[model samples]
Target chain A: MTDIATRATRVVAATGGRRRLNGGGPRAGTIAAFLIPFFLPFVLFYLVPIGYALWQSFLVVRRTGGQYGTSYTTFGGFEQYVQVFQNNEFWSSIGRIGLFGIVQVPVMLFVALIMALLLDTPLLKIKSFFRITAFMPYAVPGVIAAIMWSFLYSPQLSPLIDLLNGIGLHPDFLGPGAVLWSAANVSTWLWTGYNMLIMFSALQAIPQELYEAAKLDGASNWAIAWKIKVPIIAPSIILTTVFSIIGTLQLYAEPAVLRQISSNISSTFTPNMLAYAVASGNNYQQAAAISVVIALITFVLSFGFMRLTSKRAGL
Target chain B: MSNQTLIRESRVSRTVVMALMFVLAIYFLLPIYFLIVAATKPQGDLASTNGLAFSHFQLFKNLGTLFSQSNGIFLQWALNSVIYAVLGAVVGTLLSALCGYALAKFTFRGREFLFSVILGGVLVPTTALALPLFLLFSATGIVNTYLAVFLPSIVSPFGVYLARIFAAAAVPEEILESARLDGAGEFRTFFSVAIKLMAPSLVTIFLFQFVAIWNNFFLPMVMLQKESLFPITLGLYEWNGQTSRVPLLQESVITGSLVSIVPVIIVFILLQRFWRTGLAAGSLK
Candidate 1:
């Protein structure tokens, strides 16, 4: 044992001496060589761009000439941020998505949880088939999902519109009054199954012994689900909820695609949409400011909710 | 009597559950059903036929017309999507596996810091970074190029995070140590023993990244200006925009949408076995 220990020490010492003289094992140099090539692009593309955005958020640009031709004139410090704060358009987009969150989160998560519970029950047949069907939409590119759903909501081809018009009631799905709900429906259709898969995985992780114990106590299925299952999967439920919230706030593709079919959406449809308008309209500074503000709010909300829930759960 | 009451209640609940499941299955299949019927009809027949009913099933005719109409731009878009998804998934998975192996197995300096940074990055919204990325690419004169989309996708923070977890769980440290003692180089060890252990997770990451890059529209929308370079998502958008001016494009867009999903469905079905095993294994921990 002593000889083995001394040999180990000698090997380590030799490695150290060689590393000091030249470098450590090929592991160190190999890791460095492997990491640098891949990481360089990431640092250059993602990291630098992120840093640039944050930096640009603090500075605003000024234009000298008229609409025909203008050159960047000066920098405005936090003034563009002030403009973002005072813009009603920005606030309305926030409020719009807030309403979206309030309605969409509970309904989507509830459905997902229920589906997960049903699938977790041993009595369910063809679990694999159902799982595949339910999780299939997640593979649908968000753009295509939005496009497909948009077609279904289109006045030109929507089955719902055809049915309504057939019944002598032409309900405009893209109408200002109904468009938000239409958009929300599209989101729910695309995401519910994805969330269900997450919850189902979480549910399957729970040991069968717990259910047997509850059954021995004469627990109803609902009781088993409500008392034992939900609490155990609570972390996953909260995780999906937070993800849904972040997604709803950055909601762009649906509204962007839906806008093509409808006239109801405007420049400031959502905060991201608003940022696009500001940048496209040559209000670069203000756009940067708005982007920063939205990112900050999203960070705070997601982290805050995660902390609150984790603390409550005694994690 | 108590046993009978319990059995009766269980039976009722089971029936209710079955009814709920049936309704949901229909709901899940509803839009897909609509896409099928919509793609079958020509521009004129679209409005005339019952939206859900089969109307002569001109599936082949519409598909042919869709391809023949636009100089086969739909085919180009489909090819672009395949290239992006396949190339991005392969490269991204390999890089992530290497990085994950290093983080999981090596006791290197700054390792924890690097991982924490990546974990934080996983939460940063893509929208927040899109504009800045656009400006950077514009500055570099790579805007409207494939690299603009492909380069940014290769470094997925979430992929790295997941790969690290998988490597830690699957690849045993003793095996790596033994391989090293046997004079196998670090890279060889990673490629041989470590990669084999982490193959399932690598595939999962590949699928996830593939779906992400394939579905990505906002980046391409801002970056690419050349029409021929457009992926299916952008191509469909272009078609959807011009539909009012040229009604034939409407038929084309629906057909394109239908075709666009075929590859995705294929990938999902093919990768499903690994996907299920990966998830089940992940949850075991």
Candidate 2:
């Protein structure tokens, strides 16, 4: 079996690795053993799916002769891509997501940065209490979180609706115009703490000497926080930004869950939703194309943000 | 500034900061508080009573119905979530540790290329992958089976990335050399020596994988159509999606959401140190 071959190969590689102590330049058999377990499934599941989607995206559906004839896939380069580009739903979903990401990512990250900074400051008490409570929603699956928030968004069941109504302000969280923001709020709730934890931990890694040095210069706390701490943790801020961008592009579960309660969320409310819709309608090639497009946009946005900020972040 | 003035200023700022945090905390916890209050209310009290107030002690009754409905499909979903998360994390962590340790300890020719490729895998949207994976799984005749989701859940590129860092730090080259000099093989050295050294990191990876798999909705939703095989997220979604036609299922949906999330929240809180540390380390790269 391949397992035994891998095991034997690894033993030999280890022996060779030890004897040479120079890393032996390479061990073709040895590296494959260790990498195979992860890579086999990684390729089959991760890489293969991506490549398959790309390949599927290129091939348009074809029938041999007529409507009653046997259906098959044939070479149709760029046909699916053309359709994906021409599709109004796809572009609108992208635009809607562009709007969501524009407003939500920054707002969420700002809150997270403020929180992380506050948690880092000596003024806050019961820091872990706040941290854990904020993080609790991250543990709630997106579907359940949406379900929970759907309750809070509902007029019949929401305490917020009641609270706002008593204040002479009527708010519809799931209204056609507001449902997108409501979904964004659910996301911000679920993620803000998780992102905060990332930045806070990065803040935690900052040595005490920098703060002491800044203080010795008679720098105020605000100056020290802004000029010292923020600069030091800019890389992490950039990181969380890139991740939030990627997450924004893949927005699915929240809107999909909210779609159950609100008709405002169309089948193609987000690109992922559009892809899922297309896939569900048995337009596999189109869905594959949409997924590829979404993945490219995610790639470009995440890397673009990282590259844009890396220099300023001092990375 | 005088000492008294400075003290007063600090105190004022402290109060302001605490008040701001307190309000944000309410925003975070309010929905959960609402969920707990609503879950305890019966089907009738759900709308009739105050949303924030517990009108009756119907939590137990609701849970009874939750378990007994459709002969305990909720329980099945709960169990499936556990099986997928627990087993997936264990296998995933082991696989990641092995590959990561090898990459760290061995300087293979193509290691950097391999690592970069895997790093790229981390950015590939998992939800996007679900559709194509469904297509492949269907062709292979394994759609709707546990393996459809389970196989994909265990391959976490992020976990592997974390493992590589941890292995390089935790498992010193000298220890591996010593283990090898003792006539132990690569697998033996990894099992008997490297694994023990990398225990905490592995736990972190396991927790990461566990959470990622547990919170996954789209993958299972795309993969499994069998009601019996559905994870709790998919199950709750299905129930919520049906509440229009079946008004009564709303109560069960609320109750089931509470039940499904309780264990994950508890585990996450308790294992906070392991994952928080891992995350801090993971994000550093």
Pick by lDDT: which candidate is best? Answer: 2
Q: Which candidate is the best by DockQ?
A: 2
lDDT of 1 by residue, A5-106 (tens): 856755564557534212233545776765775577768767787788777877755556676667663656777788888989999999998998899988
Tens-place lDDT per residue, model 2, A94-113, is: 99999999999999999999
**TM-score of chain A for the candidates in order shown:** 0.85, 0.90
B211-232 in candidate 2: lDDT tens per residue? 8899999999999889999999
Q: Which sections of candidate 2 miss by over 4 Å?
A: A1-28, A64-70
Predictions' DockQ, in order? 0.52, 0.61
Task: Tell me the lDDT of candidate 1.
Answer: 0.80
Q: Ten consecutive residues with minimal summed lDDT in candidate 1 chain B? A: B276-285
Docking class for model 2 is medium
lDDT of candidates 1 onward, in order: 0.80, 0.89
Clashing pairs in 2: none
